[model samples]
Target: MEIDSYFIGQLASEEKMKEINPVLSNVKVNDSNQLQFFIEVNNGLDIPADYEKYFKNQVIRCFESNLNSSEWDDLSNKGRYFRDDQFLKFAKNKLFIFKVDVNDSLIGTRLNVTKNSLIVKEKPKNISSNNEKTLTTIPIFRDFNVNKFEKNILDSKSIGSYEYLQEIRSPYIVCGEYLYGEFKNFEKLNDGWHVEYEDQIKKIPIDFNKYKDDILITEHALYLDENFLYDTLIEQGLEKLGTIITKENKIYVKEIDNTTNDFIEEIISEHEFLSTYKSNLKAKNLVYDSKQIINFHTSIKTRKLVILSGPSGTGKTQLVFNYAESLGINNSKSQFNLIPVKPSWTEDSDLIGYLDTINNIYRPSETGLIDTLIEANNNTDNIYVICFDEMNLAKVEHYFSQFLSVLELQGNERKLSLYNKEFIGRVFNADRYPPEIPIRDNVFFVGTINQDESSNSIPDKVLDRCNLIELVTPENYIELWSKSISNSLYKNELKQENKVETVTRSMLNEWGDWHGENVLNNKEIEIIKQLSNLFNSTFTIGFRTLNHINSYLANLPKNQELDREEAFDLQIAQKITPKIRGNSEELEKVFDEENGIFKILSKYQFKISNQILRRKKKELDIYGYTY
Candidate 1:
């Protein structure tokens, strides 16, 4: 049922006449009036002359016109005109013929006529005489039994005695050396049983003798039925074990000795600390779950840098402490370390390490915390984060500028080693690991900032590298606080726990281009004035706070559609004006109706501390009633 053969052949022409007439160019006329022009076809040449009419006249019109021309006048006189010949002359000076046949019958012929000419096919051989022979002659297995027909080996015409007689109808006979056959009538000697034939079948059994070492047994192999393997394993109830698959598809069953907490710790350690922070908050009911974004470490997979910031008394420190405890570090691991940062500690040596006075040992302080972070990680691949609380209390640019550069060197060869042991000029001589270690992909830096009276602004350079997420004060904070406190302590609990959870990075992003945007509104106008006063008193905050407020509100859902004008006004009103109210004379002199609200807001500078307000409270109270 396969393709026995496939090819092409000439299709017969129905036209009458030897020479093709100008009017009937497709017609061929021979001298005897037998008309036959070559027609191209595929498969066997079964196409008859009657099928020629099926070809449209338009198809042969070009050839027809050529025949009547002077150049083709001789061709017009030929017995038949063949498009195949013309096509052949137009192509290569040769043609291709694919002759195909099935069991000696001319099933088909494919003729690819080209420029010159070609032989279509070889004439088939006559094999009928060979078919008459009833003997096997293949040589590889040597299975032929030649002595089956000894009686047929007559006295007159016989080949060698060793050769069997193979019937042949041809007049010629093959030489004994060239002839092929089996010994006929050999089966008669063995009681009509062919011993050689039976031996050939025995030789065909499966061969496994070549493989010895890898074979487990020499016995019969167990053949598996359709579902035998599945059924056998299911009966043993192996599927009941509480096992989970690893990435490679290896199943690990839960073990009481290992405990769930152990696996949880592994999973936690593998994740960057900042990413875990967001998730931890949600789990602790501190923040909404939607804000939990997974942020992993870049090159240092073992470290995390989280910067937490909010207004004063927002409970950032407490939350961070809780976070540390939840990691089981506060009790179980001495590895957990907290270091307080001061605004005055201004140098890279302050954070990295510095030589101490007593014996000139490069003693570790906050810098020791950094050293501990590097030392504590059991696996270099795990992250170890240093949480810098109130990071902006000191100008980050002032204190950490050099440290930042060293960190940026990341995977480079920057080394820090101890100096002399006796003088106050050396790191510990304990050969305590080399310094300036490559900052791992897992180590992290988390800083907390209080966006209140005593902080400097975080620089844009710092923000660009961090994934800052704002912790927005949950809407349910009051309810949660109430539940956590007695009725007498409700007010204090609410005040202490209340906070706005928002990330500084996202806040800055929302401002777009605040410096180029428009003027401030009442709310923004007010906030700006307050911040200005606070800055003037202690040199604590600067224009940066104003910008930060603008940035923060810009991202809030409530602040959507805030054009440039609205954004500027909102920053001034909500963040700037309130701080200025602490000064009574300044407030009254500038904001009094006689001076005009917009004018005072635009030009006044009552920048001073909140303590000034208490001293002027009486004057402010009197002035307020007059207004």
Candidate 2:
């Protein structure tokens, strides 16, 4: 008995057979009970590469089973066997042979009269198609002979032969004298197959016969795929084509063709012009006087190093990060770095970089200060901020002395020596080899300190170089807590709106105009002169401190949140009083007899200054030191 062709097609369409081997292109059966199947090996289907062997064994089992048995009655058993039990069983008893052909290679296996099967032929062998060898060649052409078929086909055809090539499975086709195809996708262009379909042309990854004069041409109406063209432009280092952005499902490509410096200036200008003015620390939900915020900004502009010192829990570190966030830094490592000073640090290498003699590579400290400086050197247009949290944990003059000296130098003199030789390289990759790195002007450094037994005192040299801002815990706990909760809720709402903008250097310089007037009024100058006279060389005020005081006063907000006298008094308390600490009896002579307050030598008196001075006096009278 022979298996029916209809039964074979039904078996091929079964759900079970489709799941097991859907790539089977056709199935046939011979009078000798031999089953044959042709499956695609690489026809872009999801079939596995090794499916030929698995499908051949499954087809043999399907024919050997009894289809009309009780087990075969279940609908789930559709692909287990064909429905004709008599024919399949009779064919199985006689003999069962299965052959699979893939990519023109025939592989066969035979089942004995019993139920066992073995390989009838070992390795796969090439098979001939008609009288042709059917060797796989490049730029494959159609089988039609134009000379023979032109009389019938050409007369009736509306579209040209090249137009039909678009519907072919292969990506290439030869017609008349040229190879024609559409670019399925254009990833890159090299010396390979060149295709043309209509106006669209591309160089693909197929080979062509060197002897053929295949010239491809098309009308100029077609355009290359935008994504493919954009990628190719970038891969060729033609970045002047700029970037592509999608909004509302439409793509917009922006091209830039300016010099590097001009391009950076444009980006900075855009950021600054788009940014809205707000309090420096407003984003962090902290309520501080507007004058203090301006003063902080001015200090950063004037002096690159700023010190935030006060008691712990006064939001010192929070202030540093909040100021950076307000400038759109957001604590990104490329723009900002937070180095926690360790108690064990005693030398510059512990904070900057050191030579690993055993590895012969220079290793930057865990603080990443060297990496941050290197980045600043490479990107001069942008600003970089570094915060030293709890900086007093280490002796500042010892570990931070290198920065103190290097920062004072100008231009090329500001280079920091990291290794002894000029060819020192990093441990991981030697390509990044640098013996000295310049400390760029664009970087800003901030330090937060808490004075206690666990921390060391900041030396006078460190104090003289940087601006000092003092923060005390808020007196109104109830109001602070309530506002914190409300600000958090407000930020959540703001996040939903997704409003983001950048702040830039030029904007900062323009904003500094709020403090454009550097002149000091008579009363302000008198107050400074009195303070300097009263200190009497014991704690003499220098020109830097005087300049900083004038700058702070000039930069105060025009809204008059703090009166001139009040603002000057706050500066006196922060900039001068913090430096006035001693166990000498001469300091006691400056204290008031009645309230133990340090009396101002000038005729004009400030209540805030009196309070801060009295507090320092009490500390000096008892603990022998005042912070």
Candidate 3:
């Protein structure tokens, strides 16, 4: 058997071998043309008591000569050891054989060895200490030549390469056989890495340092070096090689997709719209309190119908107009339809479309209700708002009864019949008008109502179906005027069409689920139950009120600094208390100020003793009716 020269040299220089067996001496080349060393055990001679220790030292020396210093150091750190007897057993089995070759180049030297038919590459000298540390961590790609792979591509693609790939201006790295580079004018194909570059189908690589840009990567690609890529990009600037992260100590990085970007943009747009809407409201001298604004937005998001009911001259109509204008819906007749409620309206045809036999044509009312609904149905991407200015002037149950029932239906069930089915193509133009129009989720309704002798009272059915946001004029006239003047100047400089996009159904469902699961605690449910018990016979609430309350609490903007109980209090004041109206003695018992009914409903956390409810109760007691 041929022994390696390095192992033979280590055995020859080992003093422990000499001490353990004095007959064993220097190594020499044998006739077989192999490095030879011998050990002779004398008869009747006892070996040293620490013979095992000496043998172990020789085995370590052999390991030190053959293995790399880093490998030996790592093995030593791991507390690995081999007994002399173990080494002898390995040698007897012919397992100590190794074939190694050393080569030198102008750039650096390399040590190549064979183990189980796989070549073990030598450590490069050019690698920094930081990179060496990183290498130790990433064992999966320890044998991977990332630098050579990148260099080979750069060399091969230097000429006659695809123009789009060559035009990549930002430096990137390759991971998992996919190139991630930064380049402008790259067409986005999907939410993942699939792309069409220069009209050729290709897997578009993600941007290296420009991750915050419009580029996105596939989840499978991200998993390869998710943790190490961020640090590598930061350390090497934009041009460095992508480092392989150690698989053992995995770093988690969230993958970005088009859906995530869209969701983030939606949130940002909502915030921006809210800010601009507030500014516009101030510009128009319509000062809505924070609660009113929150409830208004929440109402639109959750229920799609909101009632602005308060005394006249409180800017209720102006609030609706300003809100629409802030959302870039300036065209009153197109995006928003203002229908004046007439006292003579007592049936569904008064508000909904009616068939006219005159001139052999089915004519819609001048209110443009059908046209607005048609526009909303066609353009589902935008938010369409309709305002019933002075809606209480007529009995809402008569003219708005169909809407009251139709709004309760969800999804595809939300449809309203315009006229007879035969009239669809014959009388009413089929191209522009259908027999029944589907009430889309994107359309929201707002009604400006007043409690007076001329207007009819809004019944419990209507009150329960909609969220009531009472508008009160600000008492601080000086501050209001100052804000209005400041906002008017700012409004003139801003773009006129700051339209806010409609939130998707998925987003609303997500918020609803999150709030129902996380935000609504047991204490709030108990409070709701107690409030329901207060109006036991008069106006006890069901799941509808509970759902509205939950949705209201869920849809409130995160930045709004309202406590949990305070938010619930606002829901009670807006959603629940608005429905409580009568001259019954039980009603008097619930609204009694001394009994603290409103306070109790709010869990005694915040006071809900607003003048809206008080005025309604006072009017109900005096006139036996209130809206």
lDDT of 2 by residue, 61-165 (tens): 333222212222233234433434433333221211222222323564431111111111111121111211121111232223333222222233211222111
**Per-residue alpha-carbon lDDT of model 1 for 1-627, expressed as tens digits?**
111112122222334212323343323444554432342232122112333233222121112321112223233345245644543333222111222211212663222222111122211121111111121111111111122121122211222222111122111111211111222322212111121211111011112232222111111121111132223322222233212221233335666665645533212221123323433443344533222122112111212244665566656665655455434344323234556788887865666666555653555554466465456443553324456778887888876775555554444432233333344224443344333344543444666777667878666556533434333454555654443343233343233222312222222223243333533357556645654453454233455444454444433322112223333433343233333443454455434445334333332122121223333445567665211
* TM-score, structure 3 vs. true: 0.53
Badly placed stretches (over 4 Å) of model 1 are: 1-304, 332-334, 356-360, 412-430, 433-435, 483-627
Report RMSD for candidate 3: 27.0
Candidate of highest TM-score: 3
Clashes of each: 85, 0, 0
TM-score, structure 2 vs. true: 0.51
Ranking under TM-score, best-scoring first? 3, 2, 1
Query: Compared with the true structure, what per-residue lDDT tens digits does model 3 show for residues 420-470?
Result: 786555663666767789988877889989966778888888887888777
lDDT, each prediction? 0.35, 0.50, 0.52
Cα lDDT for residue 395, model 3?
88
